[model samples]
Target chain A: MLDKKLLEVLTSPPDAAVAIVTQGKDGPHVVNSWNSYAQITEDDKILFPAGRMNETEQNIQADNRVKITISNREVQGKSIKGTGFLVIGTAEFAAEGADYDTIKAKFPWARAALAIKVESAEQTL
Target chain B: MLDKKLLEVLTSPPDAAVAIVTQGKDGPHVVNSWNSYAQITEDDKILFPAGRMNETEQNIQADNRVKITISNREVQGKSIKGTGFLVIGTAEFAAEGADYDTIKAKFPWARAALAIKVESAEQTL
Candidate 1:
């Protein structure tokens, strides 16, 4: 189960880095962004807005496999330390629907919604 | 080319979080750490000490595809901001030799060295 601590870390301010690894033609390709948005789902899935993700979108479509990590200790002058996590999951895309609408609403530039079905999550020190 | 600004960021104090995403069996696996250690090679590869990374080591050996991100702003009460990067690369393991010895000398607990060969990199906001 996704605990409150994990939720807090995931929902932290935009300063936190979001790293997503995808299989590339040459090797493993990494796409990272200073994340300001991520919606946690009922099934523990994480939904991210896929905006301007030309290569990332293609990589995800080609291979749903992905490893995601969110970690940070700085934001708005407060040090909310001691919480980070690594999530392993399968990614699926949603072009239209309530989920897609919500994501687009949050990030106007969103081209689609990347929904990750959580397989496991581990705490990081 | 790797710039000085990026080097400063990558070599920043341990408050910054290092997130590494690797391909796993179920889908993708994420392994993260506070990362007080990393060696930047002449060819732009990033080396990290792999200690107690049972699953992560396994995953890397299986696929070698990965994405990595490092971001932070608060450490020792100083904020050095405006620098973050995403690196897409291939991962390889080295059990021993000069490269491995160098990593071991830096991190005593490190069992093996995980070297990531840089393929591409992009600045993150």
Candidate 2:
């Protein structure tokens, strides 16, 4: 299940880059987004605008598994001032769906929507 | 060579999470670190204090390839206000070496040092 702390992290003011990790032919490829850019759907799927995630899209086509890390310095951790989470999930890119429309409405540059169905979110901080 | 812009991002301020991605048997695993915690060595290698990166250490043993993303909102982007970088590199953990000692001296909580030798750093945003 997705942790509530993750929702807090996303809503909080941007403090750190959100990292999206996907497997490539040679190795793991990484892309970045900000906390302000993430939108959580009613079913708990996370939506991120895809402006130029060409390599990320290609990787997901070959393998749908994705890993993401999000953090916020303003949020309280288990025992510290900052908090973060490691999200293990599966993802797909949608160019013409409700998800794409939702993201496109928020981010004008979005050509597609990177939708992540989270399997588990572990609070790392 | 590592892009000088990455250095600027690291030194700017704590505005976004730094993500460290390593490949696991199941899939790619992601971890989080802050920008203020990274230390660049004289040789241009980046070192991070490892408090409990056991999974990250294990993944690197199987495959040394690592992907890192660091971002800073304060840094000027190519055509935007924010700037970020995708770092494709090789990494290893040091428990007792010059690298370990360097990180340990700065971060008392660190039991090991996660050192990354940069292969390339591309400015993404």
Candidate 3:
């Protein structure tokens, strides 16, 4: 079971650093950085920023089942780590939401974005 | 950076499900299961259970750096995921510590075990 505090951080409406590992022609490549979490629905759909030309977005388009690792740390000396399948069923530019103005106003660098449906979840220690 | 509560669960001495992705002779493989967390030192050393003949232990012995994903889900509609470098420096039987008796008494299936040193850490969403 996941600890209460760790879960809250993951489900909270904030940006988080997501590490995406994919099988490239060269080898296994990993990208580590911060991306804003725009929306997470009760049905397990998660929206995040993914520029058009990024390797992750491309890989997701080619392969639907991509492994994503999400994590958060707490001051109470604990941490939560979630590993699951990030099923990318759709992609679009972030110009169609109520928060679109806010996102565009703040993140002018994002060229494109994507919406991911989390098909399954498992708690990790 | 990590949220306060998430960090507490990771550093706590409870067991967690660690997804270890490794490069095998065949191809990239992943193992999803649960393991007990014995000790996490101030120097970023993390100890977990690994039998002598497990594929993960063998891979760690051959390769120093292994990708480990840890996760937790909360009742508050949040989750935390942590991805980091698990450096396996040492491996030993659990019969030489104060907690050894307890661990052995509880987990008789663990034929051998390992102590991992976490060299780096990253939070993911």
Clashes of 3: 34
Span of 10 residues, lowest total lDDT, candidate 2 chain B: B11-20
**Which pairs of residues have clashing backbones in candidate 2?**
A15-B15, A15-B16, A16-B15, A16-B16, A16-B17, A17-B16, A17-B17
The interface root mean square deviation of candidate 3 comes to 6.4
RMSD list, candidates in order = 5.4, 1.6, 9.2
lDDT of 2: 0.88
DockQ of candidate 3 relative to the true structure: 0.08
Considering only the true interface residues, what is the Cα RMSD of candidate 2 after superposition? 1.7
Q: Model 1 chain B: which ten-residue window has the lowest total lDDT?
A: B73-82
DockQ: the better of candidates 1 and 2: 2
Candidate 1, CAPRI quality class derived from DockQ: acceptable
Q: Put down candidate 1 lDDT per residue, A6-101, tens digits, no spaces.
A: 677766653566777776655555666544578776667788888666676778778877777777564322233555666777887788987788
The lDDT of each candidate is: 0.70, 0.88, 0.44
Predicted candidate 2 versus true structure: per-residue lDDT over B6-86, tens digit per residue? 989998866467889898887777888888899999898999999888999999999999988889987999998899988
Candidate 3's TM-score = 0.44
Candidate 3: lDDT of A124?
A: 35
lDDT of 1 at A53: 64
